[model samples]
Target: MKVAVDTEKCCGAGTCVMLAPDVFDQGEDDGIVVLLEEHPGEELHTTVREAANVCPAGAISLS
Candidate 1:
């Protein structure tokens, strides 16, 4: 799966990072959502989806 984030839409709630630290993180300076893995393996598919679902700002997207 491919993961992407819209930093402009991110509120830095950290929900994505908490759900899947391997694929997401926060920008050190702005606390914005950072996409760590654009394309992750099947092992992280579930977590990535959950992160997208839980993102309050709707910044996470999977395709």
Candidate 2:
């Protein structure tokens, strides 16, 4: 699976980081969503999807 995060659309919510730390993170300075892995392994797919779904800003995209 592929993951993408729109920094401009992020609201500094850490939900994504909580749900999928292996695939997502928060910027230290502004707390925006940061993409840790553009392509995560299969074992991480479920959490990644959950993070994307629960993102308050709808900044997470999957392909």
Candidate 3:
């Protein structure tokens, strides 16, 4: 799966990073969602999807 984060819509909630640290991170300055790994393995799909679901700003996308 591929993941994308819309920085403009991100609220720096860090949900993605918290849920899937291997696949997502936060900018030190802005705390926005940062895509750490684009095509994560299948094992990580669930966490990534959960992150997308919990994102308050709807900043994360999975494809």
Number of backbone collisions per candidate, in order? 0, 0, 0
What does candidate 2's lDDT look like per residue over 1-63, in tens digits? 888889999999899998888888888999998887999999999888999899989999999
lDDT of each: 0.90, 0.90, 0.88
Residue 34 lDDT (model 3): 81
Q: What overall lDDT, based on C-alpha atoms, would model 2 receive against the true structure?
A: 0.90
Q: Deviation in angstroms for 15 in model 3?
A: 0.9
- lDDT of each residue in 1-62, candidate 1, tens digit only: 87889989999899988889989999899999888889988998988899999999999888
Runs in model 2 deviating more than 4 A are none
Candidate rank order under lDDT: 2, 1, 3
Q: Please provide TM-scores, in order, for all candidate models, with all chains considered together.
A: 0.95, 0.96, 0.94
Q: Candidate 3 versus the native: TM-score?
A: 0.94
Model 2 lDDT at residue 11: 98
lDDT of 3: 0.88
Rate residue 19 of model 1 by lDDT.
87
Encode model 3's per-residue lDDT on 1-63: one tens digit a residue: 888889999999887888899998888998887888999999998888998999999988877
How close to the true structure is residue 13 of candidate 1, measured as C-alpha lDDT? 95
